[model samples]
Target: MFEQKATEWVNSYSDMLYRYALPRVSDSDVAKDLVQETFLAAWRNIKTFKGEISEKNWLFTILKNKIIDHYRKAVNRLTDSFPGMADDDPYFEEGGHWAKETQPKEWGVDYNNPIEAKEFYEVLEKCKSKLKEMQNAVFTMKYMEGMESEEICKELNITPSNYWVLLHRAKVQLRACLEKNWFVK
Candidate 1:
């Protein structure tokens, strides 16, 4: 009986689930795996699904948690030995202060306005994609998902020091990329 209902979910929700997972995981194979795992988990807990929410929303909620788990595992597996910047880090001077020549230029942004330039988010995503795996995961977890520092540290199996370093480096790289692609140009 439940088997039949689960099968119906595959037919009804797999594509939508895949679409949702792909952009978040940024990989087709991982997205497919997540969708399959979602269904399997749903099957195991099928008795607990009380239909308070629509089946689609229930499945989607399960899949979202699965995706977060996938990222957590991937981040745990990654080494925290971030690469050096090869001495061209424009944001800092020799003494670690903001470089006068490289201070961020003011943008003509309207803070009072509700909307921003659409291209800003596009460029930000592009910048995010260029980050290293661990940096990307940490950045997304902290800023995008609004996870706490301790939660991120625990999820990634990283020390607090390591988490701060990754966040700093991700910010530096993202700022440089956005300035080059969006602000400076």
Candidate 2:
């Protein structure tokens, strides 16, 4: 009986689950795999499923954990220093002055227009893809996942000061990228 119900979930929830996972993981194949894994996990844990939360919410929670696990594995794959991060660092020069080329350009974003907002988010995702591994992890955790700073620090095993630095660097890089790409007239 439970197996039949779980199979039905695959038909109904797969599209919604795939859409949610795609943007978060930023890879279609991985997103699809994660959704599949989520369904499998739900099946394995079916005995524990309580009707308290909507089934949709339960599936989403499982997918969220799968995404986090992906990030954790990605973090382990990254080296202590990545080559692109240093060369791509736009915030400061070796002498500690701000980089002139990275100064933010004026963007004519019409926040009231849904179309412009959609465009902005598209560019933002591209910018996010360019972030350093650690910076990407920390930024997504705090902003995308809505995690607290303390929680991010604990999960990523970094100090509070380091978390702030990563977040600041992510913002600066993302802003510069957006200015150059989306804001260009």
Q: TM-score: which candidate is best?
A: 2
lDDT of 2 at 131: 81
Q: Mind giving the per-residue lDDT tens digits that candidate 2 earns over 59-176?
A: 9999989988887777667667532345445578777678787656667766576554677788878888788767887888888889999988777677787778788888888888
What would the per-residue lDDT of candidate 1 be over residues 1-185, giving only the tens digit for each residue?
76687678889999999977765665679889999999999888978989999989999989878877987777656564544324455578888887886677775666587447777776777787788767777777787668899998887677898788778878987887877788787
Which parts of model 1 are misplaced by more than 4 Å?
Answer: 1-23, 52-57, 79-90, 99-102, 114-119
Q: lDDT per prediction?
A: 0.78, 0.80
Q: How many residue pairs clash in all the candidates, one count each?
A: 0, 0
